[model samples]
Each structure stands twice: as structure tokens, then as C-alpha cells.
Target: MNLFRLDASILPGASTSAEIADAAEAEWAAAHPDGTVTRRHIGTGFFPSDAWTLATTAGFTPEADHSPAQREAVALGVALAEELRGADAAILAVPLYNFGVSQHFKIWTDLVIAGGGPATPLLKDTPTLLVTTLGGGYGPGTPREGWDHSTPYLERILADVWGADLTVVKRELTLAATTPGMEDLKDLAEQARTRALDAARAAGRALAGV
Candidate 1:
């Protein structure tokens, strides 16, 4: 079995998303002790900002006329797409950044689409776990209600577009414990964290088919 995990948290040391993902991964690992694991950390291993553009343009140009950069970009897109298609299961740890998807993740997703074609179901029927974290709450009745713009897009890409058998574990108010003026929300943040972690473990087991 093979498990592909992608982490897109810029703060590796203090990423709530990663922490929740860790809980999920640990469960998966326990179930698949001999399984191979593949990792991609876009937060640290960033793609070239222009790579997507080059890859997109290369699709329109003949292979014989492709520039060196375009060829490389095309190869990268294909490789990224292959990672998802090849995986038996996948875990994506992505955090809300500035109320939306970060540039690093956006670039990676675009490159994957460029390589796989918009209609391709790269993860068809694959069990996948999506763990997303938010520093602040944006639920109904919150001051920032309707402000979260990352989760839906991620769901669309991973589940709707890729055709993955998806499970999402979300943790909100992640910064309540540390952010000023959020002292009152710390307890709620902890509760959210605990719930998310528990959900992650269960999802991981399901991903492992255990």
C-alpha cells in the first residue's frame, strides 16, 4: 500500500493543521506498518511561480517547439499529477491563509490541473483525508461568518474534481490561545482541536481500510 501526504503549512513547528494531520497519519501508520509513504511539503518546497504559466502555454505549443523551461514545467505538472493518481490513499494538511488558499498551494493545484487535464479524476475512488485549520472562527453568527474561502475550494478539487472518497477534518480558532483579545475563545479552541484530532484518527483508520 502507498500513502501520499501533502503538507502546506508555512509554520512547520506551530501548524495546527499539521498537528491534526499527525494524529491521522499516526493511525494510518499503525494500520499500515509496512506501507510506503510519500510526502510533499509545498510550504517548504515551493514551486516556481512561473511554472504553471509555462506549463499551461506548453499544452498549446507543439512539443518540438517547447522551450527548456516549458518542458521542465510540463514534466513537473505530470509528476505532481502522477503522485495523486499513484497513491492508494492521501492526506492533505492545508491551512487557511489570509482567508483563502495560499499561493504555494494554489500553484501546486494549478500545476496538477495543467498536467492532469481539468476533467481527469486522478484520485478516482481513492480514500482521501483533508485536514484544514483556521486561525479564527468563521462559522455562522461569527463576526467573520462567510469569510472562509479556502475549504470549499479544496473540497471541490479533492472530492468533486479528483473523485476521491473524501473525508474532511477541520479545526478552527486555532490561534485563540495565542492571539490577543481571544482569551475567552481559548477553551472553545481547545475543544475544536480535540474534536478535530479525534476525527482525524477515525478518518485515518478508514483511509487505511482498518
Candidate 2:
């Protein structure tokens, strides 16, 4: 079995999303001791800002007539798509930034989509686990309810667009402990974090058909 893991956290060591993803990955490692794991840390070395535009433009141009920049962009897209195509399962750890998807993840998704070509779905039916962390509560009845814009957008891209068999494990209130105004919700935040990690472990086990 092969697993491709993408981490989109700027703060790798302090990220709650990364911690949750680690739990899931540990379970997967336990199940398939010999399986290969590929990791992409997009947060640190994010895609170029204009990769999508250049790749899209290249798609319209004949391969023989492409500019050097266009060719590089297209190559990047192809490589990203190949990673997904070659994986049996994938894990994505992303955190909401400014109420939206991380720029790193968005660019990666765009490049992959552009590279997939019109007739092919690189991730068709592939099992994918998405672990996300939000700094504040956005669930129903919360003051910030409906404020989250990242999760739904990610769901659309991974499941609807790429046709992946997807499972999501989410942890909110991640800022409760450290944020000055959220001190009262620290206990609830911890509980949510625990549940999310447990769910991530279960998701990883399921990936091995266990």
C-alpha cells in the first residue's frame, strides 16, 4: 500500500492539524509496516503564486509551442497529479487561515486540477482523509456559526471535483487555550481535540481495510 500525505501548516510543530494527522498516520503505519509513505510539506515550500495561470495557459498552447515558464508550470501540475494517481490513500492536514483555505493548499489543489486534464480524474474513488483545525468555533449555534469557508470548499475539491472517497476529521476551538478571550472554552477545546484525534486514528485504520 502507498500513502501520500500533504501537510499545509505553517507551524509544523505547533499545529493541531499536524498532531491529528500524526495520529492517523501512526495507525496506518501500524497496519502496513512495509507500506511506502510520501510526504509533501506545502506550507513551507508552497507552489509558485502564478503556477495555476501559467499551467492553464500552457494547456491551451500546443506542447511544441510552449514557453519555458509554461513548460515548467505544466510539469509541476503533472507531477502533483502523478502523486495522487500513484497513491492508494491520501491524508491532507490543513488549517483554516483567515476564515479560508490556506494559500498553500489552494494552489496545490489548483495545480492538480489543471494537470488532471479534461478527461481524467486522478483521484477517482481513492480513499482520502482530511484533518482540519480551526481556531474558533464555527458549528451551528456558535457565535461564529457559518463563518468557516475552508472546509466546504475543500470538500468540494477533494470529493466532488476529484471524486475521492473522502472522510473528514475536524478540530475546532484550537485557540481556546492560548487566545486571551477564549480562556473559558479551554476544557471544551481539549475535548474536541481528543475526539478529533481519535477519529483520525479510526480513519487511518479503515484505510488498511481493518
Candidate 3:
């Protein structure tokens, strides 16, 4: 079985988001030691979000092109699409920054899943795992929880565009008022990693018809 892990941790060294992703990946690997694991760290270098112009002929051209980084965007889009095609399952681990997913994650999402036309869902309807971490007071049932844009947005994009059936695990309030006294976020990272790994294993088993 093959699994793709999208690690969007800004602080690769000490990032809770990355740790959570690690949990999922680790479990999956342990269950299926022979399975292939593909990791894409979008935090470091990823596609920049493109604002394609609305051309009169339904096709973009040199004159209609506005973003100076179109070349990079196209290259990144191709790479991302290829990666998606190669994986049977995917795990996206990202932290909520300012009530939304990080720009890195957003940019990647926009590039890979923004194709048009009916046959556009070339990478849709797959099984997906999403792990998101928030700063504080944004746990599951909080009043302001709805303000958290990461979960809702991700779900919509993956389901509607990518056609993915998803399992979402969110670790909230890693550093908040009500959930104070938290010193570090490494444990959270570890836990997330384990969870991701487990998910991968489950997916493998199902694929094997076991």
C-alpha cells in the first residue's frame, strides 16, 4: 500500500502539527512495514497560490496572465498532481494560523485541486486523513470553534473537489487560557503521528481485502 503525507509544520524541529502527522504515519508504517510512505513537506517550499485571470476565451494567455510566478505555479501543480496520482491514501497535517489553515497549506491546496471541467476530479474520492492543531480555546465544542476555518474549508475542498472520504482529527488549545500549563507541543506531535500511521494501516488492510 502507498500513502502520502503532507506535512505543513512551519517549525519542522518543534511543531505540534508535524508531530500529530507523525503519529498517523508511524502507526500506518508499523502495521504495514512493507508499505511505501511518501512525505511532502509543504512548509519549506511549495507552490505559490495563483489568481488566474478570467479570460474572454476561457483560456489564459500571456496578456491575461497577471501573476508573475505562473511558471512556478504550473510546475508545482504538475508535481502535486503526480504525487496525488501515486498515493492510495493521503494525510494532511496542518496547524491553524489566525483561525485558518496556514498559507503554505492553502497555496498547495489551491494549486493541486483547482482544476476546472467535469473530468477535473482526477484525484478526487480517495480516502483522506486531516490533522489540524489550533492555538487556544478552539477545542471542538467552543463557541468560537465555528470560527476555525481549517477544518470546514479542508473538508469542503477535499470532498467537493478532490472527492475524498475523510477522517479528521483536531488537537485544539495547545496553548490557550482554559487549557493552560502546557509547556511544549511535542507530545501532541507524537500523538498525531501515531494516529496518522494507524490510519494508513487501516487503509492498507482494507485495500488488501483483509
Candidate 4:
């Protein structure tokens, strides 16, 4: 079995999303010690800003008429798509950035969609685990209720658009411990984080067909 893991957290050690993903990956490793794992760190080496535009244009152009730029873009898209296609399962660990999806993840999504051949869905019902972390609370009755825009958007693409059998694990109030004015919510944040990690581990084990 192979696992394709994409991490989109700019903060390496401080990222709650990454921490949750690690829990999942650890479970997978325990089940399949020899399984191959491919990791992509979009937060650090993000896709080119123009990658989406180039890929979109490439999709519209005929292959015979493709220019060097279009060819490059198409190649990039193909590579990204191939990575997902080859994996048995996938983990996408992303964090809300400024109330929206991380730009890096958005670009990667666009490239993957553009790269899928005419007859194939990008994910084709692959079992996918989406792990996300939010700095502030956005659940019902919270001060920031309905403020989350990233998670829904991600669901729209990963599940609705790409046809992935998706499982979502989210941790909110991640900034409670470090961000001023959120001290009162620190305990709740820790509880949420723990739950998210446990869910991740369970998801990973399930993905391993255990």
C-alpha cells in the first residue's frame, strides 16, 4: 500500500494540522511497516503562482498547438495527478489561513483538476483523509460561528468534485494557547486537538484496511 500525504502548513513544528496528520501516518505505518509513503510539503515549496493560469490555459489548448509554457504547465499537472492516482490512500493536511484556504493548497487543487485526463476523475473515489486545523473557533454558537470558509471549500473539491471517499478531521481553537485574548479557551483547544489526533489515527488504521 502507498500513502500520499500532502502537508500545507507554513509552520513546521507549530502546525496543529501537521501534528494530527502525523498521528494518522503513524497508525498507517504500524499497520504496514513497509508501505511506501510519499510526502509533499506545499507550504514551503509552493506551486508557482501562475501554475493555475498556465494549467487552465493548457487545458483549453489542443495538444498539437501547445507552446512551451503550456507543455510545462501540463507536465506539472500530470505529475501531481499521477501522484494521487498511484496512491492507495491520501492524507491532505491543511490549515485555515486568514479565514480562507491556503493559497498553496488551492493552487495544487487547480493543477490536479486540470491535469486529470478528459475521461478520468482526479481522485476517482480514492479513500481520502482531510485533516484541518483552525486558529479560532468556528463551530455553532461560537463567536466566530460560520466564519470558516476553507473547510467547506475543501470538501467541495475533494469530495464533491473529485469523487473521493472523504473523511474529515478538524481541530479548532488552535490559537488559544499562544494567541492573546484566547486564554480562556486553551483547555478546550487542547481537548479538540486530542480528539482530532485520535480521529486521525482511527482514519489511518481504517485506510490500511484493518
Candidate 5:
């Protein structure tokens, strides 16, 4: 039961999203103490974009290449992708910037997905759990729902690259008013933490087939 925890919280403490991710890891460790856990925190920042080198390696000509720095980029992406593919289960916790995932997560995602890596789709059959936190509200079916591209894009990329189905647990801070409704949102966030932990445990069990 290999567990990979991807934490993308930019803040230091009291980050609701990171908290949820931690809860998930805790549950995984409890369920499989012998299993190893790999934690990748993107909040430390990225190592620049490696799309150019990766593109070149994928058969793109030098005319299409951007810079020589791509060697660094593609190497990092390939390493990360390899790590992701070998893992049995994954947990991604990222805060939604504006209306989507931050550039940090996106960078990692791009590398892990197909066409960016040497082999493509880091993990072709492993299931991934994405726990995302947003600033405002937007559930399943609504007029503004289409504005949300996080889950849909994530699902598409994961399926295309990893051939794995992603279970997205999106936590939107649903407070329209500036004065009130924050407490309610906090409550919801706490529940999300619990849910994340439970989900991680369940994912571990499923991965272990026990």
C-alpha cells in the first residue's frame, strides 16, 4: 500500500486545504503502518517550466524548442511522473487560485500527464483522489457551474494520461456575504477534513484489496 501525498498549500499554518491533506495521510498511515508515504509539497515552489525540453524530447524540433533550460524541466517532470506511476494510491490537496488550481499543481500535472513524460501518464491504472479548496461556491449543476474547470479538466487529464478515474472532493467556501456565513464554511471545511481522512483510508483498503 504505497501512498503519495501531494500538498500544494502556499500558506504556513492554518491552511484548511493542507489540514485536510494531513488528515488523509494520517488515516492512510493508521491503516497501513508498514506501507510507505511519499509527501510532495509544492508550496516550496516549482523548478521552472520544463515544457520545452519535454516537447523536444517528444519529437519537437529545435525550432519549436524554447530554451536549453528544458533539460532541467523534463528531468524533473520525468522523475516526478515515474514516482507517481509506481505509487499505489495518491492524495492531492491544493488551494484553488482564482477559479482553478495554482500554476504549481498545474506544472506537476502537466508533467505527470501524457505527452510530457518519456513514457506518458505517470500511473496508467492507479486511482487518484483530488481534494481541492475554492474561494466561493459552485456545485454540480448550476448556471455558473460551467465556469468551474478544476474537476472536469482534472478528470480529463487523469483519464488521458493515467487511464485512472479520479475521485474529486472539491471544497468551496460558500459564503456570499462578507460579514457572515464564514462559520458555516469553516464547519464545512472541517467536515471535508474528516471526509478526506475517511477517503484516504478507504483508498488504502481498496489498494491493498483487503
Candidate 6:
């Protein structure tokens, strides 16, 4: 089996999201030691900001009129689309930044859409695990209630748009352990992390068909 894993964490070494994803991936690895895994780390290796625009415009412009950059962007978009289409399963680790999806992930999503066509379902019927982390609480009654604009959009894309059998693993209050004002919430954060990691492992096992 082949697994496609994408991570968008600017601080990978200290990323709560990555830690959650690693727990999930470890299960998969244990189950399928011989399986192939494809990885893309957008946070560390950013794509050109204009790649999506160039790719989208290339579709409208004649082939002969396409610039070299546009051509490359188009190829990149197609490659990204193929990566999703070809995967047996997928794990996407995307942390909320500035209260929403990071710019790096947004660009990647746009490029995939541009390449796969706006309505295409690249991950149709595929099992997908989405791991998202937030620095603060966003649940009901919290000060940041409804402030999480990332999870819904992610669900729309992975489950609704891409047609994946999606499993979401979310960890919130990630900053509590380190942020000065959140010392009181550290225990709660640890609890959340433990729960998320457990869920992630279960999801990973499911993905491995174990």
C-alpha cells in the first residue's frame, strides 16, 4: 500500500500537530513496514506564492502563449493532483495559524484545485486522516468560540469536496504548556494531546486495514 502524508508546520520540531501525526503514522508504519510512503512538507519547503495563479491562468491562455513559469506551475499542479489520486490513504497535518489555515497550505490547496479542476475529487473513496492543532480553545463558551475557521474548511475540502472517507483528529490549547498566561491550562492541554494521539493511532490502524 502507498500512503501520502503532507505536513504544514512551520516549527516542525516543536509542532503539536506533527507530534499527533507521528503517532498516527507510526501505527501505519508498524502495520506496513514494506509500504511506500510519500511525503510533502510545505511548511519547510514552500512553493512559489504565484504558482497557483500561474497554473490557473495557463488553463485559460493558449498553450503557445503560456510562459515558462506558467508551464512549470501547470506541471506542478498536475503532479500534486496525481499524488492525491494515486494514494491508497493519506494523512494531512495542518496546524491553525493566525486563527486559520496557514498560507502555505492554502497555496497548496489552490494549486491542487487548479490542476484537478475545481470540482474534481482526487481522493474519491479514499481513507484520509486530518490532524489539526490549535494554540487556543475554540469550543463553545470559550472566548475564541467560533474563531476556528480552519477545521470546517478542512472538512469541506477533504470530506465534502475530495470525497474522502475522512477522520479528523484535533488538538487544541497547544500553547497552554508554554504560553505565559496559559499555565493553568497546561494540564488540560496534556489531556487533549493524549486523547488526540490515541484517536490518531486508531485512525491510522484503520487506514492500514488492520
Number of the top candidate by TM-score?
1
lDDT by residue (1-210, candidate 3, tens digit) is: 888888887878977777666666666666667989778898886543343222112235563563445554555565676787777777788888888878887766656643333235644756677777777555558568578878788877766767766777776655643344654655764564466456545643443334
State each model's CA lDDT, in order.
0.95, 0.91, 0.65, 0.89, 0.65, 0.93
Give TM-scores for every candidate, taking all chains together and pairing residue i with residue i: 0.99, 0.97, 0.71, 0.95, 0.74, 0.98
- In candidate 3, position 115 carries an lDDT of 30
lDDT of 6 by residue, 1-210 (tens): 899999999998988889989999999999999999999999999998789989998999999999999999999999999999999999999999998888888999999998898889999989899999999999999999999999999999999889999999999999997799999999999999999999999999998989
- lDDT per residue as tens, model 2, 84-128: 999899899999999999999988988887887744667789989
**Over the stretch 63-107, how does candidate 1's per-residue lDDT look in tens digits?**
999999999999999999999999999999999999998778899
Predicted candidate 4 versus true structure: per-residue lDDT over 1-210, tens digit per residue: 899999999997778899999999988889999999989999998777777788788777888988888889889998998998898888999999999999899888888878875446667678889999999999899888988999999998888877788999999999899899999999999899889988999999887878
Q: Which 10-residue window in model 4 sums to the lowest lDDT?
A: 116-125
In the predicted model 5, the residue pairs found to clash are none
Worst 10 residues of 5 by lDDT: 172-181
Q: After superposition, how far is residue 109 of candidate 4 from its true place, in Å?
A: 0.6
Candidates ranked by lDDT = 1, 6, 2, 4, 3, 5
Which number leads on lDDT? 1
Backbone clash pairs in model 2 (N, Cα, C under 3 Å; residues 3+ apart or in different chains), count = 0
Model 5 compared with the native: what TM-score? 0.74
- Angstrom error of the Cα, residue 73, model 6: value is 0.6
Candidate 1 global TM-score: 0.99
Candidate 5 residue lDDT tens string, 62-156 = 63563555555556666777778778878777777767767777777766542344446665677677777766667657445756667666666
What clash count does candidate 5 reach?
0
Off by over 4 Å in 6: none
Looking at model 6, residue 61 earns an lDDT score of: 100
Candidate 1 vs candidate 6: which has greater lDDT?
Answer: 1
